[model samples]
Target: MKIGLYFGTFNPIHVGHLIIANHMAENSDLEQIWMVVTPHNPLKKKNTLLDDYHRLQMVFLATESFPKIKPSDIEFKLPQPNYTVNTLAHLQEKFPQHEFALIMGEDNLNSLQKWKNYEVILQNHDIYVYPRLNSGEIDSQFINHSKIHRVGAPVIELSSTFIRESIKNNKNVVPMLPNKVWEYIDHNLFYKK
Candidate 1:
């Protein structure tokens, strides 16, 4: 199977993420879109992120209705402070039959070369990019690159930070989240600091 890995912290799996992943699954050549929930990096400074399992659960709840989209916790099992290149290599080793590609935003493309072993990633797999409002120009080397495919997905400007801050300030962000995810957060009283 051809899978597009959409990796993120998914702090609460908001609607922008859902829409982008769904668009990738339905519009691209990729047969499946795995919403990989990035595990917490112990080395990083503390933040308001939910526990890894909670974030993963939100992804699961948000994606449950989409047949081609599934939530994954593959990163949780990998080494800490892992680079995308390493994760790709690990996934390839484990799922030999499946062809894995990357799903990212145009903004990330601007800084793609800075990623560790980015050359290997481009050489080995395809990258499906979605639009991001006001993204910087992509690196020249990646422009018109055969390995890179720009998908005409809608431009999504919403972010998890915005949602979290909104919730913290007692603002209604229910429409920004999936029903189950909102319910879960509400029940848990997350981000209401």
Candidate 2:
């Protein structure tokens, strides 16, 4: 089985996220996309991110209707401040039979050189790059790399930070988020001013 890891903090899983994940799952060779909920950094402070379980729950709610996309808490069990390369290695060790790939935006691709042990990641796994409205130029090296694939997925400009801010300002961000996710956020009074 080939799995595509879509990593995000998902403070609240919104529609734009689902669109990208769904597009990847439907358009790419990947059999399934795991919406990996990135654990909040214990070292950082004063962020609006929700609790790990809450964010994971939101992912579950957002992806419940999408069969090809599933929510993952794989990063939660890892130590804080983990890097992508380490996560990939850990996942490979845990599930040797499955081939793991990364699903990222072009923006992340542009900054790939700065990631820890990025060369190793490129050497071991494939990367499916989706379009982002605010991305910079993709690195020349990756432009034609064998392991790098540019996917012409739809450009979703919406972001979880925008949704959270809208909710805090008492604006209805329901349309921006999944129905169940919105309900959970509303019921829990999350991101309220």
What Cα-based lDDT does every candidate model obtain?
A: 0.93, 0.92
RMSD of 1: 0.7
TM-score, candidate number 1 = 0.98
- TM-score attained by model 2: 0.98
Q: Candidate 1: lDDT of 150?
A: 95
* Tens-digit lDDT string for candidate 1 (127-183): 999988888777889988999999999888899999999999999999999999999
